[model samples]
Target: MKSISSADKLEDQKFNALRLRQLTETNPSIRAEFGESGDNVAMLIDAISRADALSKSQHIWYIDMIEKRYDDLAENEIDDIDTSDKDLKRLHDDLRENLIATITSVSIHSDNIKKSIAETPDAVQLLVNAMHYRGREELRTTAVVAIRTLCSLDSNKILFAKAEKIFKYLTRMFDFRDGLVLKAAFGTILSLWSFLDDTESNSVFTIEPSVKAHVIKGIIKLIEARCFLDDVLEFLARLSIHDDATEKMVMYDATTCLFYVLRKNPSLHTKENCAVILHAICCKKDHRTLIEMRSEEKSRRTLSRLVEGGTPRAIIKVNGILERLKE
Candidate 1:
């Protein structure tokens, strides 16, 4: 009998890694065996760690695997891919999605799992990179959802792991027109901002004026598409207070669209945010003409109805806009 060499053992491990990826996805029993809900989390993390070691990249193994295959297939540009290639692609997607699902599930389960995930070499970084990669909306959504959960505890460990990259990745998330991903992106960014220490918060998000315009306009595009996320409106209410951001908001007609949603969405959260944004733009003298022409003239009846119907904050903001229109 020939002795097994280290190379043989390595190949065996890699082979098992690939097989493990599929088994957990295709077999319900295996998936449950590795799920986060019970005692299997430790083994699950170990499996992911082994897979990441095999990948030997900044991203998770399955993501790297599928993206490479996708790149190869995309380059060919053939009308029909070979059957083997399609099967392999499906296998990679299943593994990638299931592993990401595990990561997301484990993130929300327990503080211990959160800490363990963070402790896993490059786990948090890989999750962030998954969001950064292009053309995979579901991948981005799941990874960011996990990030939101991990960051919920506000552990400096997670934030400090390539924190600048994480910030940039999330800012890019706003540019995605897919409303579902954008909504998840908004909630994730809110989590980061809600807890970031002042120094990091100021530094990480302080983009150039053009970049700020791009982000604001991106959100406006979503409103035009009628995505109308309350988190987005809430974010805008906070951000538009800054003079330059408010300027971009006016340039992009955010005030009018916000009013459109305000009249349309009866949710108190929506009402207050729209009121706040309209009021902020109203406060700026340079843009009041734009506000008057674009939003106020169209807003009085809606604002009047809101004055009698909304929360105190919304009412105050509505009254302020009406008072401006009067003057």
Candidate 2:
């Protein structure tokens, strides 16, 4: 009897999970049963957990194989398989990315599945690895979507918040040239905020002044491009509550950008958030003076009129901005 290797076990788990995902997605009965039955959910979670462990062990094995291959090269010796280091690297990447597919698939948009996945740090580690895989954009994007879905669950917010390195990867995600990937990436970065009520989850950009500033600048650029205006405006609104974040927004001329958002026929919510961000930035005398001098004439007039009418939230924020503009 031959002992099965970790790589074989990993492939088996990945196959099982991917198969289950296909059946659940394509069969309504199976999907319903999987969603309703704790047993089915448990089975899926177990498969994912086992896969996580096996993949980690296989990563170690692959590394050892590479080192051995390097030694063999030194002796002018070759493996029977005739594989190169590049070939082995590609094989490992394919295996790992396929595992990411299995993960995203098996969840099937179930919160319970997402919660279970989020609770398992080992499972989360797989997605984190994909996020760090710079060579493949789609893999990193899928990992970001999975992370965004997991973080959407309030129960998992603290779990993600605890992984401070995830924030760094997320910040790097903005560098991608693909518009849709960039959108999902930055949106996921902002989605961590719904955990505000939890003590352990509240840090949201608490580390690294450079990271915080970059995020501010990115949001401003996205807003200037008129992509995801409402959401980015809201992000700046919440973010500017801190002096440090507001300082970056000011340095980047975000106040001018927020005022430009007024020309876009924004919703009341957008108007409120836009006003809120401006209000935050205007709290300082130099900042207020800057907005006063730098603001466009027509947009400033449009905002001034908002002091009289709009949603109560919008009116309040508008009032605050107008009052500060005087100082």
Estimate, for each residue in 1-327, the C-alpha lDDT of model 2 and write its tens digit: 011123255345344545555665577666555555655544444544444454456567767877776665644445533455445444445544554554555566577877766665465665665687645576688778778767777777767765746766776777777787777777777766445423424444244576678678777777877877777787788887778888888888887677667766678788888777776777755645455534653445777655555678888877776665565
TM-score of each: 0.63, 0.67
What does each candidate score in C-alpha RMSD?
A: 7.4, 6.1
- Candidate 2 accuracy as lDDT: 0.64
Worst 10 residues of 2 by lDDT: 1-10
lDDT measured at residue 12 in model 2 versus the true structure, 0 to 100: 54
* Each prediction's whole-model lDDT (CA): 0.62, 0.64
Best-performing candidate as measured by TM-score: 2
Candidate 1 — what's its lDDT?
Answer: 0.62
For candidate 2, give the lDDT of residue 116. 69
